[model samples]
Target: MEKLAASSLPMPTTIIADAGFDSEENYVYAVGDEKEPRFEFLIPYGTSVQEQTRKYKKDIQNAKNWTYCEEEDCFLQLKI
Candidate 1:
């Protein structure tokens, strides 16, 4: 992350990553204050009550709304 921040390449406004890099420390680093370059990160949290609830899962699956990625061969059910 530090290397990327220091690199000459253009930085993106947003970043998406798997659960492995999901943590408070990383969040703080990626989303710094106004003095720093801000980045909006999309990282899924670990399993929790919301994810375990039957109603939540049912709603997500029943919504029939998903964003598919052909390259990754996956579907993302966006709530927003």
Candidate 2:
């Protein structure tokens, strides 16, 4: 973004990017100073869609699938 801002090319009215470009710094830069804005940003969180899928929900490798053992204070390994 710094390079783009310093470049001679005209700034775009809106900036559309994938999850890879989603970050706090990018958001702040796009918002500009005060109430002004450099451009409209359309970026989604990286896990926005993947977390809702059945594959992600059932995947043994995903931490969310691990069952916590309160007494042992650890996550039980899931058997295939």
Candidate 3:
């Protein structure tokens, strides 16, 4: 952690993390985003997720089952 902090490297504006880092502790540390402009994190947490998918099952998310965004390279939830 020290290596990542003391490198004088630019922090990412937006970060997407796994559900493992989605706790309140991580959220508090994410306040650093305020210091660094555009430092936003889009971490996914299954427990916090409340979106209902009629077409796709939460257990299995296949590439063909969902729409993809070329820019984000992730599945896009289409509201129909």
Candidate 4:
């Protein structure tokens, strides 16, 4: 993210990443806090972690928490 911020390329409105980059810290950084820009991020949580959280499982079963990106034309299963 810091690299992207430093690059000449324009900042993306949203970022989509694989489970390899999934982590609580990463989520907070990408989404930012009150003082920083809240860049949208769509990264799946780790399967092991998701399996352990009842709310996560319930949301998946209910299909009520998906984040859809029109530009990418894909549904992001889990986002933070």
Cα lDDT, all candidates: 0.73, 0.82, 0.62, 0.75
In model 1, the worst 10-residue window by lDDT is 56-65
Candidate 1 local lDDT, 1-80, one digit each (tens) = 66777999888888988878879888878768554737778888775436667766657564444778799999888764
Report the Cα lDDT for candidate 1: 0.73
lDDT of 4: 0.75
lDDT (Cα, tens digit) per residue for candidate 2, span 28-69? 878878858877879887887798888888789888788999
Q: What is the TM-score of each candidate against the true structure?
A: 0.53, 0.54, 0.45, 0.51
How many clashes does each candidate structure show, in the order listed? 0, 0, 2, 0
What residue runs in model 2 are displaced by over 4 Å at the alpha carbon? 51-80
Query: Alpha carbon lDDT of residue 63, candidate 3?
Result: 42
The best candidate in terms of lDDT? 2
Give Cα distance to truth, residue 25, candidate 4, Å: 1.2
Native-vs-model 2 lDDT? 0.82
Model 3 error, position 17 (Å): 0.5
After the best TM-score superposition of candidate 3, give how far the Cα of residue 36 lies from its true spot, in angstroms: 8.8
Better structure of 2 and 3 per TM-score = 2
Candidate achieving higher TM-score, 1 or 3: 1
Flag regions of model 4 displaced more than 4 Å.
35-37, 48-80
